[model samples]
Target: PTLRTSLPSSSPSLSPTSIPSSSPIYISRSNPTIRKPTLAPVQILYDVTSPKDDIKIYFGKDDNDGREGPPKPHEVATNVLDNSGKKYLNYNDLGSGFTVEVLDKCVIKGARFYPANDREGRDPSSYKIEGGRRRKNGRWRWSTIKSGTIRLPAARIKVTEPKLDPRFPHAEILFENQREFQMYRVTFPTLKDSDSEHSMQIAEVELLGYFTGGGVSLEGVRTTPISSSSLIAESSNPVSQKKRFKSTGTDRAENLQHSFEEKGPNYLLDLTTQYDMVGILKMNGVFKPDHPRYKKLTDKTGAGFISRVKNDALVIKPAIGKTVIRGARFYTSDSEEKYDPSSFVIDGGVEEANGEITWRRIRAGVLNMPSARVDRKTQNIDPELHPHDGVWFNNDEVYDMYRMTFPETKDNSVNYEMRISEIELVGYRSTRKLEESNFNIYDLITTIYFWRYEGSLTVPPCSENVQWRIFDRPIRISPRQQATLEWLIRAYRDPDTCQRATVGRPRRDGTGNVDVVRPTQAIKYDHLQVHCTSANY
Candidate 1:
């Protein structure tokens, strides 16, 4: 029986010119080096495919580093080329395999494949050809282009009386629109004869198309290499919290300086004095059993005192760059009864050139303790919930801290309450050298000794992974702001219940000003260091 058709039969014996150099070009979608239509024949060696086959082989390179030349079809399978023995890349147990990015946009007319000589149950019978366009960021976004099956005969020499053995070496798979595209990906969804266990192997693959920019003669077609290192880095740390800051400019520094001078240095308070008061009490009334972790509390105060209240341990996530910060919460010590939530102004600015930094007030608000602990608290804290969250400074040279004051309820009250409010701090440096510098917040701003140490999270599950930062300077807030904070703390209700919790307990004396903070612990063997900074002028 003789088979005849309008389409010409493809054979390995025919000259490469027999196939039109323009319509169907022999291209290794895997390799970007060879762009011509004609390809030198390569052989495939027989071997079992492994699950760990590097998909990068399809890109025409031998390894991830591209140190070695492209693999010969017979030497080993770097990608899914099906030409020779021991050189075929395999699909995993699931028949899905690899994809390759093309160098330029082309109008793909059809495709051809040269199966390996030892093809048995391992040939791909049906599969999909996908195409993609390159985005501005140099990534190819892919979509399915065509779907078809292997219609050409297997690689076998035919037997005819006059030595008419038609070489069944190439399978011609046609495409729909000759659409232009920059990327192509192939996937073998199924195998021949309902066999799922065998992996697909192809010795040589060819795509028939012309460049879309002009024509076949167009020179200097641009190509972008898919960076392997960037892909690896992204996969390793997807959501890194470390932030860095950059300097802005120095023009606004003078106006800010004038504003600070008018306010005066008395506006700032040193919170270390409050800690000294706790030292005098010998931590008698500080430890409360009703705290989140009652067993962790100790009699000591200042540094090492662990209490049941989760807030005692110094835990913070630093936002160094343009990080957005949401809201804030307040906590108090057990001995502090006159303390109330405080209101203050928040200023944000960028560091500028020549030691001149400019700042402007961004937010004016108050911070309050939560009325409902269980209903408001979440197991995992997301630091990005606020709007002002990200890195603000280019480096760690000059940093900003929020200062708050809790004034006692009385006329002309000299006795006041103070503590550092927890911030959604991120990008904190674990190790750094410190030196005193003439960096001033304002003429009104006072420079104070700041300490950095490790503490536990002051909440339930009391995790001891907090790095605490305490600044010596505290900003001033008016009495009216303090009163507003008191009302908010006492009146604020649990969103879930729509009602405020009872405040008549022993520690909470219905004044709406209870100690929400973790009791100060004594500094044991941990080494402590103080650092200071001021304007360079």
Candidate 2:
């Protein structure tokens, strides 16, 4: 039953432009100045044709306990018709064909194997093998998968258009919050492609915050459970993991909270990056004690992050602000009758869904999409009701959102903890298809959770540490940008600063109008970056 796709009405809007109070103000509604992003002294990426086909090895589920045995002798094995489907297995299977889609929960998403048919790319001396048994065709060939490499270490940043004091709101500080402030760390110039100077192994580091406006270079790639109202966070250097303890107390303590029904197979963000909103900047990220829960943080309150409260009063609730919930809806609130923990209200309306996302296109030769003309009565709605379309931001659109105003410094003294304005990027990609149609024939083909991390902000108490950058080519957006990202994630989930404005029914309102709430920031994590280094629970 995995077949869903219902939203594509048309979306993409930002056009507002208004800074002229004689311009040059920098970013100060009162003490505003942060735009520092120049750090890349850490890196890792591998595609040596197949490193256990890129780590995430699977097969035999119910979440596995089959006890990890078969599958890798080079892990190119396959078998069609599994997952309650039917049957097919050619050498247990290993590449050439397979594809099926449906996740954001409609479930079903497979792609077993795909990478063998001599698409032509071999010559390590033709594998050096040729002197077989009975002749050269009797049996015993060897050499199907063996080429592992993913070294990383990098740093190259260049930004110079500032000599400010038009009031002073200039920025560039990536994770340096007074261990004696440390003169602002910005050293990076090491990766000629790195063969191994340890190849820059800092795994999941953090600290990135920024702001630079207009002329349209607003590059952004953030959204996937990384928030402090979506900007300014630092700290990515600390983890011990107890030592890889495999205990598993129920889906790894429920996959360590952040499940809005599977948002990005583990952090991803890619806001069509070309670079924009230039104002505040800072960055730093790494997490490798040997990851999996490496620097762990069951979130025992370091103020670093992960808060949603109200399950019988853990209190703190006012969710929704991953860019107004990704649709860039218009959410405005810093004060309006109620909902105000301290700022957020950009209301521009969004929440359109008919969903569909499944990939393996590498240049679109086939991953499939076609079908969707929708209207099976539009899938008939009420699957617990989502219904969103809201646009309410008038006052000339909240004065056109203070006319994009984000640069203002001078005695207004901007130090929201030292200046971290924005940066967030979370990503994932894993899909396989060895061969089959209509559904069924080898499984685990869709681990394609999308998110393109790193947007910069780390420096200044390193607020929630977010200097995440993951890009080696991964982009796919239109369906009206996924129904304007389901109407900007339902207008950036405002839940009212924490009285309860998040969880289900477009935030419920049987006609009560008490929905849409967000505001509860304080999970700063000091220097954040510990990519699931452990999860035994």
Against the true structure, whose TM-score is highest?
Answer: 1
Cα lDDT tens digits, model 1, 40-85, are 2211111111222223433222222223333345434432332222
Q: What lDDT does model 1 reach?
A: 0.34
Per-residue C-alpha lDDT of model 2 across residues 54-149, encoded as one tens digit per residue = 122222212121222343332222111111111111121111111211001010111111111111111011111011122266743332111122
Compared with the true structure, all predictions reach lDDT values of 0.34, 0.19
Assess candidate 1 and give its TM-score to the true structure.
Answer: 0.25
User: For each candidate, what TM-score against the reference?
Assistant: 0.25, 0.16
